[model samples]
Target: DQQVKQNSPSLSVQEGRISILNCDYTNSMFDYFLWYKKYPAEGPTFLISISSIKDKNEDGRFTVFLNKSAKHLSLHIVPSQPGDSAVYFCAARLKAAGNKLTFGGGTRVLVKP
Candidate 1:
């Protein structure tokens, strides 16, 4: 099954705190992993990514860590801000699948100021 799952549909955090979002996948063939952030009524923008060959990737305030053996991944945002409130989607792609990505439903985060 190609289910890229984000178990929690929503999260809330106070500004300046750390926000963590989790994702899990069952497909062993997935090699490329990506995370996207979206605002209301807008398309998702790429956040960070990690390959099956690596365990962690970080970009500015955002960081992503992968545990290949466990089929788990997590995104961490440090010093979360009110503007950071949005929906985050985790995606994966199998090279054999032609780079087509399957996305998780999404997790909505609200950073309260």
Candidate 2:
């Protein structure tokens, strides 16, 4: 069973719209959550993250929200662009879990212009 899960396999959005991706976790031990974007064969690039202590965190074009009690989190990309098309993964880790990150399957996003 996957500790972290991305229920949506894929998503599509217009170039200038917002893109939302969702994830859920089963472990109450997870203390940190992060979202990553990956291109073809390259490693996943870190996107936005939120600590369990915070409800939300935001970057320039990305935002992450966490609901500890519900064990859910979501990533929001504002004004999605064509270049943003990629496989987005949700990851979680326990501060005491030896730095290993548990990852969700991934959500493929397509931004159409």
Regions of candidate 2 where Cα sits further than 4 Å from its true position = none
- Candidate 1, 94: how far from true, in Å? 1.2
TM-score of each: 0.97, 0.97
Per-residue C-alpha lDDT of model 2 across residues 1-113, encoded as one tens digit per residue: 89999999999999999999999999999989999999998999998888899999999999999999999999999999999999999999988969789999999999999
Q: Candidate 1 regions off by >4 Å?
A: none
- Maximum-TM-score candidate: 2
Task: Give the clash count for model 2.
Answer: 0
Error of model 1, residue 78, in angstroms: 0.2
Q: Each candidate's lDDT (Cα)?
A: 0.95, 0.95
